[model samples]
Target chain A: MNKSLNIDAQTVSVEANKTVEANNTVQAEKRLPGDLAMWFFILAELTVFAVLFIGFAVSEQLNVEMFVQGKAKLHQISGLINTLTLITSSFFVALALTQMHQGNGKQAAKLLVVAKLVACIYISVKIWEYLSLFEQGIDIETNTFFTLYFMITFFHLMHILLGMVILFFVAIKAAKNEYNASNISGFESGASYWHMVDLLWIILFPLIYVI
Target chain B: MQSTNANKKNTLSWLWLLILTVISTYIGSFLELFNTQKSLFIIIVLFIVFLKGQQIIDIFMELKKAPKLWRRLLFAYVILLPVIIGLIYLL
Candidate 1:
């Protein structure tokens, strides 16, 4: 009888350990940095950009001379400035997240405002570039190169605007101390989207302007 | 203390990214000025683009701390897109 009791006790102990281990696994599974939904959106955005890039490549291959000429007309200085501005803005946003995580909400908000201001510079420069192109009679209907150029860039610009809107709301919440280290999913989601915008530009700049 | 270390690392990454941007711009200008071996220049510039994308994914996006699968997928996106484009250009 004592042997049977000992066997039952061992079984119960093993079951309890198994439950504890399962609970630990559940806790560990929550370690992803941002909202799972945001990752899905990011994946979709990246896929679209990839397709557009491939399309651009195919078009360029078919019309290499025209593509070269169109690329030559682009303002390298303006492209470089915009690249720098976007990258700096990305840095600011990343820093803002760091500040928020450190419990410095106001500082985070200020950094985001700075990032927005830099984004404004990028937008203004882009507008000047578009006006220059328009003055030179280069529009979406100009050629396949310009068509792809304007379409891709303008689509990306819309994403930038959307990212700004997201950052604006994130900044407000951050200023109100809404995010903590453990509750930064919203902030991270916004940052992730903004970084996506930056990533697209990083690819677009060299592809369109330089190469 | 850990947060401060992270902040420092982020700052350094930002500075490195900026430097890479400047270097790529200089390379573009060099190619424009010399007009030599256009394919080679394209490859170099696109390589820079790939590096910048990776840095952003790893550092700015905080995928360094993310799951291994997420990191691999993102890295693949950054690397593969440029590689395919480079191949298309070369062909």
Candidate 2:
């Protein structure tokens, strides 16, 4: 009888240790989650956007009146909607990453699906906004604002499309239970990219639409 | 990851981002109202943008606990861009 109790106690202790170790593994200690190469890529991308952003600001400075007039024609409502949409998508992706870290791969996959759905809203709104501008005969060559507007926003749209594709593959892998607490680097890399897309649009909304 | 705490913080960050975005949009909507204090208004909007950018960097990007170098690089971008724009607009 004593032997059986001793065996059960040892089993319980070993199980507790495993749980603690699993939890600790999920909690990173002052480290980056994604690939170092992805960080370099992000820096490079930010540099390009920086130059484009600076150019737009300087051009607006050259002729504030023209820029303001150009801004008036852009759809503010659509801009606001897109900003909210991307931010929401990013939020979902963040949660999904957290879930993945906790070994909840299926739940994380579901969150990414939700993130992709929100991304689709952004795509739909953006395409509609573009078509509306076209309807109003406001192509890039129409003026300096339109030029920068089309160039900057279209560039951003392309990134969003790419991000969606990445998220799609990530979601599929996640649903397959491919990533777990210890092996989430690839998933983290994809999520970081999506957040970057969201980050760019946060700045772009005010730069292009409101400010 | 202490998921419950992490989730709570993320939800809070999302709420803050939502509030800040709406506030900036509302402020920018009042063209005539802000016409007189255009420079001041631009400054305020940039400040709000800074807040939103910080939230994105630290919360959504999950860079707060990252190495100081990486966090500072991204934060610098957020700071410099708005400052440059605000300076141009003010000028």
Candidate 3:
């Protein structure tokens, strides 16, 4: 009877400790249930991309020759390079999650910073590519293909910018040690969104430029 | 203990996703099979995407371990929302 009473006391202490720890965690991390929100947002954003894609498909049907011609005019190498950058960034963010899981918040923050840098490189090169095409006499009004090209790629760049912003915030939180494995949802969601951004580029690179 | 479990889950899911990303990118590039057969390529790519995406949503987002209603709501968002949007686009 005494031993059972002792065991009950131990269990009570453990439960109390758990509750205290949970409370401390909530205070320290303040991570809103960010994953569901991010996923739903991604789903909505993908829909927008799909609509634009459908627009492109319909337009392509109307003007296949123009698409072929525009594909010829744009620099495929730049598109490929941009795709590589985004892919590398996606991998970096994935590694960031691993770093956080390992309790290396500073390292995870650094990875996110590096990811953001890669995103900046992607955006810069994309803008330069667009401007160069314009200086070379390409315009959105030039043809149906150019219209879809600028529209879709511009929307994509905006998403990249938005993603970089989210990464920046998550990086700051990680550096503050508020994004360890217990509350890594923000980091994970940011990485997922970045992956989606990268995935879109992967599809767009070949579709818009190659075939 | 909970944190450790979360860590293991994150690492496993991240690895799965990286492999998926690499494979899909290669598939998109190499398969000019889509050139001659547009709808077929779309179907295959979309299927692969849905698989990868559902995994990410389920694992990384913790939907698989969530309550039944939470999972149902997420499934509704994933499945129904896209269909609604696509129909709007079609119109």
Candidate 4:
């Protein structure tokens, strides 16, 4: 059985290496078309987010009064600002992808830099918002809604950080002219991930602070 | 696959997203759409984001141009599983 398992592991590694090699060839061939694998990865990510969304929904339904009562104390203005920031950042990333497609690698990298800066600004504002809320004595222990609110938004924030990191890497790669119209999967994938992060914040900002 | 010129058209779409976010925030402050008024804002916000996200997926992600089966599978996996889980939890 152990020998069979070792064979299976070796086979899996071989398959993985073959996939990498094939994908690299596709990249080299400038056949940077979209693929099912990326979508499958995205679908998996969304499923995890959906679970948290469900948690928020169930908690709100279970303790409607407490949730609403807690929501009233939220800082809506800060939330709105953060939402705008994320949306604007997403716009930059999208624009960056377009620039990459136009063969303006330098400009594309600049746009990505802009996107990352905006993301950093958004994070700073969010940290401020979180701290101010804490100062107002609103913490996860406040109630179920606030607890879920903090958890979900903070969770999404981590994703934004990750997106920022990826964008930075893509920006550096673009600087080296590694991505162009013919080889843009990295840029496209990074933009897609950033937009997803922004879209999640779009949902979270209002759900936690505005409503 | 959009060029810079095509991106100009998309800027309007981004503006629309911004406007929607603001409008939803304003609406949430006043309206009660959910079962209770408390989470009405959150529900509305989620709806708006979901709508916008679908648009981005279809357009920016170019999912509409993808193979029909691939699109269907993608949507089913992302949308169906969580909904099923949520409903089961509710039940």
- Per-candidate DockQ vs. reference: 0.60, 0.69, 0.17, 0.29
Tens digits of per-residue lDDT for model 1, A1-211:
9999999999999999999999788657536677999999999999999999899999999999999899988898999999999999999999898888899999999999999999999999999999999999999999999999999999999999999999999999999999997899999999999998999999998888877
Q: After superposition, how far is residue B26 of candidate 3 from its true place, in Å?
A: 10
- By lDDT, who's the top model here? 1
Cα distance off (Å), candidate 3, residue A74: 1.0
- lDDT tens digits by residue: candidate 2, A54-133: 89989998988999899888889999999999989999999999899888889999999999999899999999998998
| Candidate 3 ranges beyond 4 A from true positions | A1-34, B1-91
Model 4 CAPRI rating: acceptable
* Residue B41 lDDT in candidate 1: 85
lDDT of 3 by residue, A29-94 (tens): 443334778868876876687667667766766776777678778886677668667766776776
| Pairs with backbone N, CA or C atoms under 3 Å apart (clashes), candidate 4 | none
Which parts of model 2 have CA positions greater than 4 angstroms off? A1-28
What is the per-residue lDDT of model 3 for residues B1-91, given as tens digits with 9 covering 90 to 100?
6556665765676566556555555565544555666444444544444555565456554456555665565455445433443343233
Q: Candidate 4, residues A49-72: lDDT per residue as tens digits?
A: 767876676777778788778777
Tens-place lDDT digits, model 1, residues B1-91: 8678878988888888889988888888777566768788888988999889888998899988777888889899889999999999888
Instruction: Categorize the docking of model 1.
Output: medium
Q: By DockQ, is 2 or 4 better? A: 2
C-alpha RMSD values across all candidates: 3.7, 7.3, 6.9, 11.1
